[model samples]
Target: MDGQENEEHANRGEDVPATDRAPRPAPRRDGAGRTGRRALRRTGVILAVLAVALVGVVLGVLAGGRVSTDIGPFQADLSVAPAFGGGTKVDIPPLGALLLDSHDGPTHLTVELGALDQSRTEALLDDPASINRASQSAVDDVREGVLRLGLRTLASAVLVTLLLALLVFRDTRRAAWAGALALVVTAGSLGTAAATIRPEAIEEPRYEGLLVNAPAIVGDARRIANDYTRYAEQLQRIVGNVSQLYTTVSSLPVYEPAPGTTRVLHVSDMHLNPTGWQLIRTVVEQFGIDVVIDTGDITDWGSEPEASYVGSIGLLKKPYVYIRGNHDSGRTAAAVARQPNAIVLSNTTTTVAGLTIAGIGDPRFTPDKNTSPAGSGLTQQTADQLIGVGDQLATTVRSSPRPVNIALVHDPASAGPLSGTCPLVLAGHTHDRQVSKLPEVPGKGPTQLMVQGSTGGAGLRGLEGEKPTPLTMTVLYFDKDKLLQAYDDITVGGTGQAQVNLERHVVEDPQAGVPAPVTPTPTR
Candidate 1:
């Protein structure tokens, strides 16, 4: 009956809602809908294909962008790639890299030294004209190599992009489009890099690897910036001179380390020079140093800003026992104490690397004009004040539970009272190295006093003299009894020179077997 009613309604030509009479012809999709669907699918496919092509191109560029060329006597490789920052990296293998903030972009350029022509380098030592010729040749080769590398890298990218596109789309036209996009990217990058070339960045380059040697390797930036030709000549001369010196040293006899000996590296008057750390690290590694002792003046000005220099103390990985110099402050001492390997001695005694040591901070804070005293004691403490401080330190050492093997003081003047209080007294404030026996003390054997020179080449102040001061450091060897056995004094030419000298000294104690009797220091 329901079916008959529905039929009747249909016959009446009225809308029939009863039980839905046969479904109306399925709605036909409009042309607009079809077009929209097709477009969405096409867009997805295009995006996916482009992503694949980009990956392929980048891989190809990274793999094939490098070119090797001869620069002077060195063989170097030049390469480029997309990176976070636009800078140039010069890598001298086994030493370190020089990062130059050359431009502002999204790419990186690397020049890596691969090899050196030994014969050419040796010949350069004697031939002046050849050095100039070689420099010019290097410049030309670098230019050509960069050009060739760019072209080859672009070609590689385009080829890889096209191949990936063809594999994904199976159409020549689409593949060509992808290749064109890659070509634009590679060409634009190369063009941007070339346009933004910053030759002046070489003037202030950040060095890596043996960074302390940068000044020696690159020469004075101001001088070099003024005369490129002169810089090249100087560079050539340095290489030749250093090579000769190395050859001479290599021919000398190698010293064997005595067994059961403790090695100590004594560095002083760093004056916030980074090179001082370099020298310290170098000698520590070469000499197998067990402990490091710095007398003072690690900073030019003992401000909070200079405190960061103490951070390197932990990097030494060995015990670093330090005493405050006249240039240091309580803030500086706190920074040093924060280091894991650092031990700051202030009117205190402690054992380090098996040797019991005591130290006293300088009585004066010279760099802080506001806090320092007036008159002769203005820059530093007067002789009287130093002697007073030394007496206090001597009393502390005398009361120590263990015998004091070493006593550290920043000023030699103050060390006067410390004499005979300890077997060895180390000081540095004079910027000159001296080893002497203090006047014989009643009932006490001879006491050795060692004054270290500026390990930082006297810092920037040294530049004021006719010649820059040489960097000095000493390696002290102590026997099982913690007595000085011998020491090697090493002096390195400051910036602008390539010279090194080493002198060895042996300490002969009159009574070698008997320990020096500790006596109460008489007040001056």
Candidate 2:
């Protein structure tokens, strides 16, 4: 019965062998795989979009117009050329208008950086491979920013080409044309940036070029630009101080001299201080000075390098009568002689402002050829020569048609012999001022020695030590008869920028023997 049942089931096909039955179709796997592929496509599109946006921004920056910004005291304008292999140029317009006319006119300076170095170009591009991680982190940041921007631009180009091919053109030929045009634009911008911009543009200047050629042109323009900025700052500071000084002086009480009297400005021991020129010019114009007397030490070492400063005195537009001090060399005297308005006196007499002036320069050369530090002290030989010169000058004055009204010398020691020869004696070299009336010379009138203090406080040396002497200048007023009547002393405390004090000292008639009048107390 079992055999008969098995035969019947086999015959029915439901009982067919398992191996002979066809295998059921494999389950569908398109769902997860298709999902993954769609996710990848979305990610690529997003990346492409970001890249395209980055490229646009970068191209705009590169092809944009020039940039301008202020760096400290300077206004700088920078222009980058668009063409490959071209250069970048920086222009600094003339600052004359802002300089208070310190210069003759507006001066423009242009700096052009030719084709940039490869390394520098790479740095500007922010190529991480070219940057060193050990040196500075800023370089790394720059590189990262550049790379990120560039990658996004490339990705965008790819995505746009794909979109054009599938959505717009739906053709390979159109997609290729669109992709090529986008690449060309991006390449052009990058190429221009690489050619023009350089690392030197942003680097700190060395200023080494300043030592070689300065106040005019420079090999390294960036260094000069930096120096110019600093100079502008210093100039502004100096101008402010000078303006303040003028305002202060104008507010002080005026010292009116006798009518039709001659006024003389006495300046001494400038010691190469440029500020002295400014002060002297101011005093000459303000006082209506008829003559200028400089009892020298005009230069610090009296070297050939310092001779040029002598020309500045001629700017006073007054009769500049000069006598050499221990610090002045023959070169310095020669320079003084070149000035049209300068009168160099060496045991000679010249009439100025209707008064006979006799002067004898210090005879000894103070600068030793072999000394490490230049010598400035008066030597015995010079002292002896000074004495002889003084005697000769006194004799010459006595025999002249007009008696010497004023006697000028550098050292007070040399001024002793001129006492009886002239009523007024002016000298400098002590860096300290003094007023003294010599004993009556039996037959001649009594002589008054007015020694001026250092006009520049010994120049830069004044600021070296713990205590520095004050800068001083004197103005002498003459009576209608050309006789000394009164004088005003101007003193500036400290060096560089300082406060000015004016003191007026009167000279009473010697015959009356009355005490000299006290200086009027300053109101401010």
Candidate 3:
């Protein structure tokens, strides 16, 4: 073949060996290939700019994120930061922060009350009307502080982004773009945080502090709205309580509990509220309680869904003796019994903390759905069932070889038949606390019927009323002989209020060698 034809054949790879074929000339770049290369370069530049802008914005935020302002009579600094869950944190320096689950977002705003203007505070205190003015101005002050913070943050972000972009890219256009992008991101973040903020969260703030008296200093929040009168009273009470708590806590003596004395915590009507469990746990630890006795109404419906609340029993870490209430069912009893530390009583007697106790579950099961206004208080049918249960409990107490130190039931009336069978009969169904000396019966000793209030603040139903009910629990001091010596009724004010009143009542147990009952005194 001719040379030209041979070259064409080689180009086509038709009749040539691999090594004998001439090397192909380098292929010229096409429009599409050039376009792809340009696009990749642009993409790389954009990514590099974005990463630089993000770092610049973060550094800017850290530099100029916080602003100081006067909120009422207090001086505070406000700041914003990235967080997994959005919330407002009020940091009272040297004390602790109060966290409020205010909204759902990616930003956490913090208000640190750094100092109190003593002169302003004193003047405001002297002139009550100044408080209203200060409170009204607080919102404006906070708004101004936030606006200033936002402006500073944006300026810093733009300046930093521009400098970084210029230094990295050595191009004015890229630096401008980076600055603009940073501005947009910072503004959007601030706007989103402000838009999602929930001011109502202050009604239920959670305290995170170093001091053990934090709970006493800042009472548990439930739900409070539109009750400014109560709010003012609560604020005053909180100030007073804080002072008292600090004094008591600071001067606490190194002492030991009485020898052979057993502290028993009596709690009732949890109503499936998790907060009640927290309160119980705190009280148990604070008072060094040996045993816990729950009268009834651990749940409102006693349904399967409510059964999970009973699991908190095992967390108590102390012997938790319980009896079913009118709102509880057999299933609830079984659930309580399933807990590791729970001892369910259904017309049965048991020994705990060196004392023989007998208890009976309420026979009635009046869930919220089945409840009526008339039926809320004891009805004829309910009374009859209670009496029967009480009789059965009394029989259990009598059958026991050891004398029953305490008898537990759900209703005060049920405790009537249990009189004289045991020295103390505890019951709780009427969401009110009362102590009654039952008439003497032909048996061992005079019975004291102690009815407990709602420990869960009557649960969610508590919010239905004009005012929420305070959560209440009692601590009973039993002597070595298992005789009651004294007791403290702990009452925690409901939402909008921050008062924890602990009143002590010394019982004159003739067996305990006491002459008469001392009048109740408010401890704190």
List residue ranges in candidate 2 displaced over 4 A: 1-243, 368-382, 510-515, 521-524
User: Cα miss at 254, model 2 (Å)?
Assistant: 2.7
TM-score of candidate 1 against the unseen true structure: 0.54
Clashing pairs in 1: none
lDDT of each prediction vs. the true structure?
0.78, 0.64, 0.76
Per-residue alpha-carbon lDDT of model 3 for 3-85, expressed as tens digits? Answer: 68778887897885566666799988698899999999999989998998888888777777778888888889988776678
Residue-level lDDT for 263 in candidate 3: 92
Record all residue pairs in model 2 with backbone atoms less than 3 Å apart, i.e. clashing: 48-155, 48-156, 51-152, 51-153, 52-156
**Model 2 backbone overlap count:** 5
Model 1 scores a C-alpha lDDT of 0.78
Question: Which candidate's lDDT is highest?
Answer: 1
Tens-place lDDT digits, model 2, residues 1-524: 35566567678865755555556999999999999999999787555544543444344434432344322222334333233333322321211111111111111112322232545533423432322332245445435544444445444544554454445446565555556655665555544454444565433322221122222232345665568656445444544555555565555555698688899999998877776787788788877889999998887667665676787877878999999988888888999989999999988899998988988887666642221111256466666766676677778778878878888888777766676887888888778888877566778777887789988787766766667667789888888788777778887665435477888877787332222766854632
* Candidates 1 and 2, the one with greater lDDT: 1
